[model samples]
Every structure is written in C-alpha cells, then in structure tokens.
Target: MKLSLFIFLAAAVLGPELCLATLHNITVKGELLCDNATVSNVKVELREHDTFDPDDTINAVHTDSSGRFEIFGEEDERKLTTFYLRIFHKCDATHPKVCTRATEYDVPEKKLDSVYDMGSISLNLQDNKELGRRYDRDSEECD
Candidate 1:
C-alpha cells in the first residue's frame, strides 16, 4: 500500500511535464560543393543542440552521387528545438595531421515544419569558423 502511494505521487508530479511534450519535425535538403566541384559520399548529420546534455543526432545520411542530400527528422521535446547540420568531409583536408573537417550550419526556427532548401553550400575551411577536425582510424593521411 505504501509503494502504491509513492508511485501515485510520483506520477502526479511528473505527468504534467510529460504532457507538455511537443512534436517537432523538419526537412532539410541541400547540395555540397568543394571549390565548385560536387562532393559525393559526404556524411551529413542532423542534430539537436542541447545546453547541459550531449547533442542528439536526429538523422544521418550521405550525399548522393550528385552531392545532394535530404533528411527529415522528428522529435518529442519539451522545449523549443534548435537544429543544425553537421557536414563531415575531407574537402579542405591538406595537412597530413587532419583527416576530416566537420562544418556546422544552423537551421532557422522559421524553417521548421517546412522544407528548408540550402541550395548550394561551398565548403572552405579557411572561411568557416565552425570547423572541427578529427582523424579517421583507418586512414593516417589526409585525402
């Protein structure tokens, strides 16, 4: 009987928070380019930025042979969702120490619930400050 009372109080306290969950959906499409050339097989990941917790990956996909990709994701979040695209490629990887360059692009909140077309994105590491570097375990040298 005591355990049942505890559970009831717990649910009563948390139920409202759970009920406040909202569903957010977004669609993003774009083409990747490197120096006016199409970049295929590049990894594109849709992520939700979090303040206190690790960012969540909504979906991951690779650019097609034409360097175009489309991703759709949905999440049940209690707060407003902030989305971004993380593009992983070796476009400007020149130094042997660098393997892959990760670039980020923020998605505007107005674009939610509708298709956001990024058109053509040319990746230049020097011009982009949102660049991150990491190495591929299989390859020791940059491509």
Candidate 2:
C-alpha cells in the first residue's frame, strides 16, 4: 500500500512536466550571393541547439541555380526549440585556408511554424560573427 501511494504521488507531481513536449515546425528560405552575383549549389543546414545534449540537424539543402533555397523541418521537444541556419560555401576563399566558410544565422523564435524569409545574403561581405571554417582533408583541391 505504501509503494502504491508513493507511485501515485510521484505521477501526480511529474505527469504534466513529462508530457509537455511540443511539436515545432519552421520554414527557412533565402538567397545567397557572392560579389553581387547569385551563388548556386551552396549547402544550407537547419539545426537545433540543445542544452546538455547534442545538437540536432533538422534539415539540409542546397541553393538552386538562382541561389534560392527553402527548407523546413519539425521536431518534438520538451523545451522551446532553438534553431539556426548553417551555410557552407567557398566564397572569397582566395587563400583557401579552409575547405569552406561556415556561417550561422539564428532564427527568431517568433517565426516558429511560419515561413522566415532571410533576404539576400552576400558571402563576400565579412561575417561579423562567423561560426568557423570547415576543413576537409580528403579534398585534394584548395584555391
């Protein structure tokens, strides 16, 4: 009888918290440019940032011939999901210190479950807070 009561009390206390997971969906679209010209085939990844857990990749895509892209994804999370876009490209890489330049753009939480259009982004411009650079050893080319 004591064990049964304890279990019932525990369930009453934690049931709501355990069942608070929500499904979040987002659509991200943008145009990529380099030196005022459209950059095609650039890789873009939508990701979720987690606390005390490994980050998750929601979706990934490449820019079209017109440098346009639209990607969407959904996930169920107990806490509010944080999202960002990771762009990988080889723009303005004359020295080619790395295989590609990676940049991140944070998505507004208010844009959840809706389309977030990130107007034109120029890769030639300096990335004020660049995430980092990508180095691929298998690639035999660097320019």
Best by lDDT: 1
Quote the RMSD, in angstroms, for model 1: 2.2
RMSD of each: 2.2, 3.3
Write out the backbone clash pairs for model 1: none
lDDT agreement with native, every candidate:
0.87, 0.86
lDDT by residue (1-143, candidate 1, tens digit) is 99999999999999999999999989999999998998999999999988899999999999999999999998788899899999888887777677788888989999988899999999864555456557763575344
lDDT of 2: 0.86
Clashes of each: 0, 0
Per-model TM-score on C-alpha atoms: 0.90, 0.82
- Judged by whole-model lDDT over C-alpha atoms, candidate 1 comes out at 0.87
